[model samples]
Every structure is written in C-alpha cells, then in structure tokens.
Target chain A: MMCGDEYRESLRRLKPEVYYLGEKIESVADHPAFIPHVNSVALTYDLARAPEFEELLTTKSHLTGEKINFFTHVHHSCHDLVRKVKSLRALGQQTGSCFARCVGHDALNAIYSVTYDLGKKNGTEYHQRLVNLLKEVQAKDLFLSGAMTDPKGDRSLSPSQQKDPDQHVHIVARKQDGIVVRGAKAHITGAVNAHGHLVMPTTSLKEADQDFAVCCYVPIDTPGVIHIFGRQTNDDRKCSGCLIDQGNPEYGIVGGEALIVFEDVFVPWEHVFMCGEYDFAFDLVERFATAHRQNYGGCKTGLADVLTGATYALAEVQGTVGASHVRDKLVEMVHLAETLYCCSIACSCQGYALPAGNFMADPLLANVTKLNVTRHVYELARLAQDIAGGMLATMPSESDWKNTSVGKYVDKYLKGVADVPAETRMRLLRLIEGMTCGTALVESMHGAGSPQAQKIMLMRRANWEHKKRLAQKLSGTGESRHD
Target chain B: MPGQKRRVSLKYCGSCNPLIDLSRIGQVLPAAISQETDLLFVSAEETNIDTIIILCGCPRACGNKETIRARALRCIVVAGESVDAVPVAEKDISTAIIKKLKPK
Candidate 1:
C-alpha cells in the first residue's frame, strides 16, 4: 500500500474540478479549508505504517496473497469482520474524526460478495472484474467515496415517480462499449478528495425503476463530472485567521461531504458492475447499508472516547473538575461507549460467510449497534456539554482571544484557575461545541440509515412467530414447551 | 505562523471512573493554545515529544499516561472533581432515590 506521503503527493496528479463558495478549487491538496479533512484521511495511510497499528490496519489480500491495507482486504472469516471494527476504532481515536475510508471499506466488501451471486445468476464476469480493480486500489492505497444516497426530489415519490427523472442517478443511455449516467449523488463523503467513486443505488427498486438501478465505479475526474464541496460550520476559521477557531484544525469535522453531479458521464464496460439489475437493487442497498451500519459501533465509539475525555479534561481545566454528578455522568458516558463497542463486536463475531467468502456483519446486531449510536453518541455529546457548561456555547471566538487590544482583558476574565490558562479552558469548550452540535450531531442521527431504518431491520429479523409460540406454549395454548 | 513556538505533548488518563471528563482538555487545549504553541499527542510508544499535558477525569488518575515514551519539558497534570471515595464500579447506582429516614 502507498504510504502517507505518497498518498498526499498522489492527489497532485488528479485535477477534479471541485467548487467551494463561488470559485473552483485549483489544488485540493493545498487548499486550507480542505487540508484538515485531507490530513485526516492521510493519517489513515500514516497509521497503517506504524509498527503497533500494522496488525489491525494491514491484512493480506485474499485474491493476490499480497499484504494490503485493511481498508482493501476482503473479510475471509468472522474474525476478519471483527478485526475490521477494531481497526476502524483505532484510526477513529487516532484522528478524533472520521478517516473517510470506512464507507468505502464497507462498500467494497458489500459489492465484492454481491457480485458473486450476480455472476452465478447471470453468468457474468462481475466478480473477477471487481477483484482486479480492488487489487490495483490496494497496491495504490486509493481513497474511495461510496456514493449511495441520492437527492430524492420528493419524499413521498419513488425514483421513477420523481417529477425530475434526474433526481435519482440513473443510466441515461447505453452504448456499445459502455453506458452514460446522469444525476447527482448527495452528501457524498470524501468525494472532493478521493481516487474513485463507488456508486450504487440508494434504495430498493421496481421494474419501472430499472433505469434508476445503476451501479458502477467512476474516476472522480471523469468528463462532465462536477463536484460542489459542501459547506461546514466554522470552516472559514481554518483558512485566513487563527487556526484555533477551527474546532479541529487537524481533522476538520470528520470526512467533509460533497455533492457530486454525474452529468452524462460515461462508464466503460470494464468499470460497470451492475446495470438494469432492478430486481436485485434493493437487495444491493440492504447489503450495503447493513455492511456500513456496523461502522458506527467502532468509529463513533472511538469518537465517544474523545467526547468522554473532553468532558473530563475541560472539567479539570475549569476548576470544576470533581463533583458527584459529574462523576456519574462520566461513568454513564463510558458505559454507553463500551456498550456500543460490545454491539459492534457481537455483530461481527456472529457474522456468517457468503459464497464469495467475505463475511457480512450480522444484520440484526449491526442495526442494533447503529441505533444505539444514534442515541448514545448524542447523549455522549450532551453530557460533554453538560460538564463543560454553557461556556461551551458562549465562549469568545479565537479571534477575540487573539485581538491585541481586547486580548488581555478577555483573558483576565475567562481565566479558570491560577495554574490553567484561560485559553486552554475556552479552547476545550469550543472543541466540545464543534463535535456536539450542527452537522456532527445530525450526521449521527441520519448517517448509515437513521434510527427508523434500524427498527425496520430489527422487526424483520424478529422471530415473532417463534416468540409467540414460546409464550403460548407456556400458557398451554399451543405446542408443548419442550422442543 | 509564529516562529519557534513551544510545544506541548498531550496525554490522557483512561476513562474508567472519574469525577471529570478528561478527554475534553485534550480536545480543546490544542485550539486554546494554538496561537502561542503546538500540542502533540504522545502515544504510548512515542518518546521525547515535548512538555506533557496530563488530563485526568478524577483525582485518582488511574495510570494511563505513565507508559508514554515522550519526555516532556514539564508535565501539566490536571485532575478533576475530588470525591471522598472512588467507586470501584459505578457505585451508588440505585434505581430509586432513597430518602433519609425522618425521626418520628
């Protein structure tokens, strides 16, 4: 796999036209606003090279028998699934943000297994085609953004029912060599700074939606491709003035998302994985979502550790460190954090292998894990804000703190204790604020298929008939209790 | 962009049982001190990083930073809420509030 330095230098070669504000991004690598998130992804490359993290971050490729970054390695056994989460957690903690690879990690794994079944049914060479591309990805340490969510024009309407057909990404036309695709992929994570886009259908499909059920890999710089970088809260803080104003100048609020428009982009036959596979599209979505759901268990928990730590450190800096309630809250935070980890491990541990040999996470437990995260990670942030106090919200901007005329007076008042500096106290609160509010918080709720999505899976996985029979047997209204 | 700013190597005590949330300091301190200094987190295997800023959730400060290879210029250990006794395992976790008995 390419090392961190190589990865950073590699981006210089690709010139994807990424727009932010009104201007086009000339150099994605050096752009101040994009650098932090870019750095976070680069850290993944760096961490894999670390001696201690090598075991969790690097694995052998099943197809080529070459050592590959765990991000590219297919899960050959249940242990591989479990190890995947561990690696994600390790990197999440290291970056204190999203590394931007896990979505693609799950996407590649999901597509790997699904194509095997597709090949068997259609007698196609989809599996081998994907395997070859993935081998190159591993050797190059390529970054991929899984483009799944679409901009559904109307919530109540299906893809086919949309007033504007392009609201959902679809096949515009088919050619002898390949096909042309059009429409936008919304909230595409790491798209502006990725080597490739792993495109897939966002939802289940019907016969009418056959044109919408398109999936393929497209290079980010494909002709007619347009990337509009999504705006992030306090993003400008990273650019001109004080770096401290940017809550995480090092990582910049996890993987910065973008809206990518595939304006009649062509995909060669070699790159097209699925097209017009409407009957299986929904299954494709289910496989992708379930595979992706298992990530929150590890990544968010890794984030939770940081959230929990922030609460503790800030309390100490403010001289309000030790209170009984504070202790209880801290304890609760750890309990919730560990609980999520347990769910992730349980799901991975119980995963069964597919015919393609990669093991997908247990759907029920994966859903269960993400559902807990939707609540627990929020609570973790709430408790953080609680311990850190309103100062977390009301703290002066870093600019005010650095202002020559007002800086001294501001520092004099905000000072927490004799030993700890006022800057330290306020900055800690800002970090808490950055992680707990706005996009960060909402991402937890909606990302990886929201709370309702998990509930639907749980209900489907529930053995209601068996459960009812058990209760009936106890009441002597059904079959005997003994099996 | 200041030249020759001093650096602080950050360390966090494990989040077992504590009065304060320790990780917040690590999160906020970097930005707080960014104008005049840099904060480098010294992982366990890392050594000779800089002055260390040790954040402990509570007073007990269960030994999570002792193993860091970094030799700080000076160590800033911030401990949070000092309770009389540390609970071995989230002690005093009763479901219902037990009121003090009133004498008749």
Candidate 2:
C-alpha cells in the first residue's frame, strides 16, 4: 500500500492544469479548498496499510497474487462484492462524507469484466492489456478517478447528432503507437487529486458513433489535460477558519468534482483498454452503474446515520429529546436510513459473477437501491433540518460568536438549554445546515444516477408481462383463463 | 360530564401544513375535536379558506361561518397570507383561540 507521504509527493510531481475559483491551482495537495478531499483520498491509501483492516481494504491481486489495495483488486468472488460494500461503509462512517475513491473501485471491476468479454468475442487482447494495467496499479496502489459522463450538449441529441462534435469525448486520431482522444468529462469526482484517470464511454453508441466509444487510462498531469473544479455550495467555508461551518471539516463534500478536458491527449496502446468497441460500450456502462449504485446504499446510508445522530443530538440539546413526537420522528428517520442500508446489503447479497469472473451487483436491485436513494436521502435530510429547526439556518457565524463584544451576548441568548453551551448548538446547527442545504444533498440526488435514470432501468428490467399474465390467471379476466 | 368518556378521530392528509402546531396538537389533543365537536372550525390559508367557508356553509350542517372565519384568519396570519381586515374583537378572539388551542 502507498504511504501518505508518498501519495502527497506523487500529487506534487503531477503538473495538473487545475483551476479553483477561476485561478490555477499550483499545488492541489496543499490548497485549502482541495486539502480536505485530498486527505480523504489519502485515507484510502492509509487504511490499506492498517493491520486490522487488511482483509477488507486489501486484497490479493488476481494477476500477481500479491496483496494490493482493494481499490486496485479485481472482484474474484461474491465475498469481494460484500467486502467492497462493507469497506466503503466503514470509510463513509469515518469520513462522514464522500471519500471519492469508490468510483475508481467500481470502474475497475466493471472494465475488468467487460474488457474480458470483449476480447473473448472480438479476439482482442484488451483483457490481457487490462490485466497488465491492473498489476501496475496494484504495485503502485494508485488513486484513480473514474472519468465518465461526457459533456452531453443536448439532452435529446446523441453523440453524433450533437451540434458540437466534441461535446462527447471521442478518439480524435489513431496513431501507429497509440490513440489520441479529445473532449471533456464533466463532474469527474477526485479528478484533481487522483494520480490517474480511467476514462470510459458515457453511454451506448451506434455504428455511426464509433469514435465516441472509447475507453483508456491517462495520468492526470498528462500534457493537454486541463481540470476546472466545479464549485460546491458553501465551498468558501474551506477558507474559513471555523471547523463547524465546514461540516465534516476533515472531508469535503462528494469528492470535489471537476471538469476534465482532454485536448488531444495521447494514450499508449497498452493503456487504451477499449478503442472503438461500440458493441461492448453499453455493457461496460451498465456494469459500472451497477457497481456504483451498490455503493450508494453503503456510503450514503452511513452518511444518513451521521445525519440522524447529529439530529438526535440537536434535539437533546434543545430539550426536546424526551418528547414522544421527537422520538417518533427520529424513529422514522432511522427507519428510512436503515431501509437504504438494507437495499445496499440486499443488492450485495444478491450479487453474481460476471462471465469474466468478476462479481457484479444484481442490476435490477442495484438500480432500485439507487432509485430509492434519490428520494429518501433528500427526505432524510429534510427531516434532519426539521428536527434541527430554523436555528440551523439562522445561527451566527463562528467568527462573530468568538468576537469579544458580541461573544457574551451570543452566548447568553443563543444557549439552547442551560447545560449545553451556545457554541455547541451553533456548531451542531452549522453542521446540519452544511450537510442538508449544501452540495452534500445535491450530490446525493445527482450522483451515481438521477432518479429518472434508475426508473428507466427499473422499467426495462421489470417483468411486467409476467405479472400481467399472473393477474389474468388468478382473476379469470382473460379469454383463455381457466378458473 | 365528569363520568362521560368521549372518543374522537381527526384525519389530516395533504401536502402542506399552515398550522405550525397541527402536528403537536394531533399528538397532544384529545379525540373530541373529531367526534364531539358540534361546531367544526375549518382552519386554512386564505387561498383555500374562502372555498372551505363556501363548502361548509352549503354542504355541511355542523360548520359555523364565524368559527371557520376565525380559524381561517388564524391560519392566514400563520401562513403569511392576505385576508380582509379583522375586527378588533375578531383579532383578539382568534389570537386567544390560537393561544389556547395551539399553545407554543
């Protein structure tokens, strides 16, 4: 496993074209806006080295049989899928926010299976190339940002029909040595902090859109690669000295997504895992979605647990802890939170091995889990705000609370109950506001896939005709039905 | 009256709540509001209050226009909605009713 210092050094070496607040980030690892997210990624590396978490966080690489970070390991069994969820939940609980590595973790598993199947069908050596890449990733324990979701210009247009051909990431040229790609991947989590990026096709392609169906790996600092970090709600809090104002001060919201622009970047032939394999693109996207959707149950539920705990504490401090109504509201929150957890676990338990021998989560259930998440996570956050009360939004800034003139007055007036300090209530409310009303909730809604995406998958996978036939048989409403 | 036991049931189903204490009152108040109330006070925002007044006066027998108007005015105040000017007595009466029925 990579050491924390080594990870920091590696990031320092990368001359990534990263911008934050409209200015270029000279040193992302040390920047205040990016440091917390970097530290969260560092934990992924640090945890693998721990003796207690070795089993769950580290796994024997399928290629070398050497123990590697679980993020770099291929799923060899159903146990691996379960372990992945468990490990992510543990990380989520520790961070109290997105750790930003699950995308790469799920992406690797997906490409592993899809590439193998593609090679089997097309007689391509992409699978072997991927295995070689996996060995290198294992040896280095590299942190990779899975870059998907191209800058789709129009919702109704396909990659070929787009007014701007570059709106979707596509291979610009095929050189003798390798291929060159151009375009941008938007909302890429951990792009600025990662050592490398695993670029995948965003959606399925047709024969006409062959160039758009491309996948490869490239270092973040590769020449011509530029990163423009997307702003999060209350992102300015990173510069603020108050820890409470920045909820989960040690880990920022949802991996600090960035728009990664590839301006004719070259990919070595070995690194180019999928080039113009249009038929396999959909499978790859679906598999990636499955692994990622399974992750929501684990990580988001862990976040919901933190929100629930914080809300409960807020209630206690407000002298409403003993109220039956308060107790019931909390109970309802717990129920919804645990319901999400159950979906995650259920999907994991129902996982099966892909043809390439990597375990994949059940597609229908995983999609359902994510679908339920898009709704309930928001509801949970709303309920948290309700229990936390308007004070969460109206609390005084930590700096003002510390001012000499106003400090005493704030302390005197803002005290929730006699026992709890005014600062404590302010801190709790700030944290609640940060999580509920900010980027955290939006990330929960849009990340993985939106509710509409999951509903589409659920409709496609649902056995509606079978249900209709069964209903006809039981109700004797059909012409051919026998009682 | 001391010996008699009464049970009442109130059902609330909708998207928004103008009564801030409706949830609390539902839990703390007895069932008499649902069952034993010969006079039903329909509290709603002004946007819907006028409609409630019309329906209650026309279709329902137990509905009292004064009580409905008072409740409606109270809800309007709570929801920050516009309503016709309230008489001094009506304002005091509604405020008193709210304080008694939905105490903070």
Candidate 3:
C-alpha cells in the first residue's frame, strides 16, 4: 500500500481540471484551499502503515492474498462489515473530520456485488471487467470519488421526462469500442483530489429511462471532465492564512465536494460496468445507499467524541464543570452519541450475505442509524453552543488577537479562569464552533441522503402486514392472515 | 539452554481506542522478559523469530489473526488486561507475559 507521502505525490502526478472561487487551480495538492482535505485523506494512508493501526486499517486481499488498504477491500462476511464500522470510527477519531474515502469504499462494494448478480442473471461479462479493474485499483491503491447524485432538473419528473435530457447522466453514443456519456454529478466527495470517479445512477428507472442507467469509471483528468469545488462555511479562513479561526484546519469541515461535469466523456468498453440496465439501477442505488448510510454512526460518533471532549474542556475552563446541569448535558451528549454507535453496531451485527457472496449491513437498521444522526448531531451541536456561551459567535478575529495594541485588552477581558490563558479558551471555543457550526453540521443531515430518503427505505423494508398480524395475535381480535 | 536466549518479535494493533496502556507495556516488556526467561526480544521483521507477541488494546485482538500469527512459530496475544485469554491485572501484565515466555 502507498504511504502518506506517496499518496500526496500521486496527486501531484494527476492533472485534473479543478476550479475554486472563479479561479482555475494550477495544482490541487499545493493549494491552501484544498490542502487540509488532502491532509485528511493522507492520514488514511499514513495510519495504515503504522504497526498499531495496521490490523484495523489494512487487510489481506481476498482476491490476491496480498495486504491492501481496508478502504479498497470487498466485504466477504459479517465480520468484515463490523470491521468496516470500527475502522471508520478509528479514522474519524484520527482525523476528527470526514476522511473522504468511505464513499468510494461503499461504491466499490456495491458495484462488486451488483455487477456479479447482473452477470450471473444476464450472462454478461461486466463482472470480469470489474474484477480486472479492481485488481489495478487495489494494486495501485488509487483514490476514487464515488459520484452518484445527479443534478436532477426537476424532482417531480423522472430522468426521461426531464425537459433537459442531460439532467441525469445518460449514454449519448454507443460505438463498437466504447460508449460516450454526458451529464453532471453534484456534491461528489473527494472529487478534486481523487485519481478517478466511479459514477453510478442516482435513482431507479423504467424502460424509457434506460439511457440513464450508466455506471463507468472516469479518470479525473479525462479531457471532457471538469470540476468546480463547492463552497463551505468559513471557507475563506483557509485562503486567509488565519490559524485558530479555522477550527480543525488540518482536516476541513466536510468532504471537499465538487460538481463534476461530463461533457460527452468517453469510456472504453472494458471500463463500463453497466449501460442500458435500468432494471438493476434500483439495486445499485439501494445497495450503495445502504452501505454509505451504515457509516454515519461510526464516523459521526468519532467526531462527536472530539466535539464532546471540547465541550467538557470549555466547561472546565469557564469554571462550570462542577455544576449539576452542565454535567447532565455532557452525559446527555454521550448518551446520544453512543446511541448512534449502538445502531451502527446493530446493523453490522445483523448483516447477511448477498447473492454474490458479499455481506451488507441490515438495511432497516442502517437507515435508522443515519436517520438518528440527522437529529442527534444537531442536538449535539446545540448543546455544545449552549455550553460554549456567546463568545463562539462574537470572538475577535485571530488577527485582532495577534495585534499588539488591543490584543492585551482582548486577552484580559476574555479570560475565563485565573490560571488558564484566554488564548486557550479561545482556541477550545474555535474547535467546538468548527465542529458544530455550518457546513459540518449540515453534512450529518444530508450527506448520505436526506431524512426522507431513509424514511422511504424504512417504509419499503418494514413488514407492516406481518407487524399487524402480531398485533392481532396479541389482542385476540382478528384471525391471522398467514403466520 | 543455559547460555542461549530465545529470539522473540512483537507486533501491535494500531491503538485507536486501547483499553490498556500498550506503550507502557511495550516499553518494559523487553527487559522484563529477558530478566524472567531466556528470551531475547527482536524486530518483527527478523526471519528467525521463534515467537511473535501480538499486543492489542482490546479482546478483538485484531493483530492476533491468522495473517499476523503466520509470521512466527508460535504467537502470544496480549489483549487489554488479559494475556492469552486469561485475566491479568494492569500492574502484573508484564510479569504474566514473562511467566508465559519462561520455560516449563
């Protein structure tokens, strides 16, 4: 597996067309705006090489029996599923932010199983093609951004009914050697830094929408591919060269998302995993969503651990740690965070094997895990803000703190305890603000899917009729339909 | 048996949330083991390693799996406050490990 420095150098070798703040970026690896996110990913590589982390971060490849990064391994058992969660939490604790690799990891697993099923049922060669591609991906330890969400022009209309055909990625041409696709994938995590993209359909489809059921690997620097980095709250702090204001600066707020436009991008026949297979689109979407959702409890809980620790420290610094209510709020935060962890562990423990011999987390429990995250993370943030007090919002800029004139007054007035420096208090508050504030908080609600998306999955997965039968059996009121 | 010391190697699970102090155990184990038994600690990469010591923070013993154990003739697992599935106190863990390495 590649080491952290090797991963950084690998990004330097790629020449992706990435634009940020209306300026075309010359090199993403060197840019301050992108460095922190890059560092977040780099740690994943570095940690795997450490002897202590090797057991969790690196695993032997089932395909080749060689040691490889866990991010690139396929799940073969429930053990693998549970380990995935544990590994994610470990990385989350290390980075204290989105590590930006799990999306691609989920994509790989979903595609692996889905393609195998498709090949067995349809007598196609897509599965072998994917295996060959995966061999290289594992060998090189390449970073791939899983690109799924499309820029749906109208939510009410399906892909074929959209006024603009390009709203969802579709096959624009079919040739003897390959196919050409066109559309844009929005809010793709780790887009600018990744070596390539594993693009998949966003939603299920019908016969008329067959053209949109396309999944292919596109290199980031491919001629027609263009990336525009998304803006985040307090993003300017990165470019401004201020240290303390940008809380958790080493790993920025959320995954460095980007809008990737595919202007008739061509893919070799060998690289295409699915095309005109509308029937399996739902399977791919559901599986990918399930795998991705299973991660929130692990990663977010790790972030919560950091956020909770910050709140406790701030409370102590302000001389309020002993208060009963303050202590209660801290306990409440732990309860909520651990509740999320329990959900993730439950789903992973309940996981079963798929038709292709790979395992997946229990769908209902995984969705429940993500659904709880949407509410609990916000509550965690609110409690953190409540404990932190108003200085989180009104604190002077780091520059103002550094100034020789008013700096003393700023320091003298903001002091909390007698022994602790005001600077310590300010730094702790900034860390909490970064974790609980704008972009980071919003990611919990919508990153994998919105709350409604999980609700939809729950509705489908729930055994309502069977549940009704159980209720009838208990009440002795109605005859059992069929036990 | 009187003059020669058995060579041993140590590996660790990347302590993300270790329940025990792995670093402290790692620091004192070499001298402790040498004093108690005719065992000399060596690098994990040594080809002639007689026994591999896998130090994990939890019972998960992630480093004690087949792939890791396949490195040497025999393996010893130190998970949290336990050695080889037997409970040991934090203060006596080093002595317990030393006991295991001593000849019968």
Off by over 4 Å in 2: A478-483, B1-104
Error of 1 at A163 (Å): 1.9
**lDDT values of the candidates?**
0.78, 0.76, 0.90
| Chain B TM, per prediction | 0.55, 0.24, 0.90
Model 3 C-alpha lDDT per residue in residues A196-253, reported as the tens digit of each score:
9999999999999999999999999999999999999899999999989998889888
* Candidates 1 onward: DockQ, in order: 0.03, 0.01, 0.54
Highest TM-score against the true fold, candidate: 3
RMSD of each: 12.0, 20.4, 2.6
Over 4 Å off, model 1: A479-483, B1-104
Which tens-of-lDDT digit does each residue in A257-376 have in candidate 1? 999999999999888888888877876788888888988888888888787888888888877768888889999999999999999989999999888887888998999999998999
Q: The CA-based lDDT of model 2 is what? A: 0.76
Flag the better candidate by lDDT, 1 or 2: 1
Per-prediction TM-score to the true structure, in the order listed: 0.82, 0.80, 0.94
- Candidate 2, chain A: TM-score against the reference: 0.97
lDDT of 2 by residue, A297-326 (tens): 888877777788889998988998898988
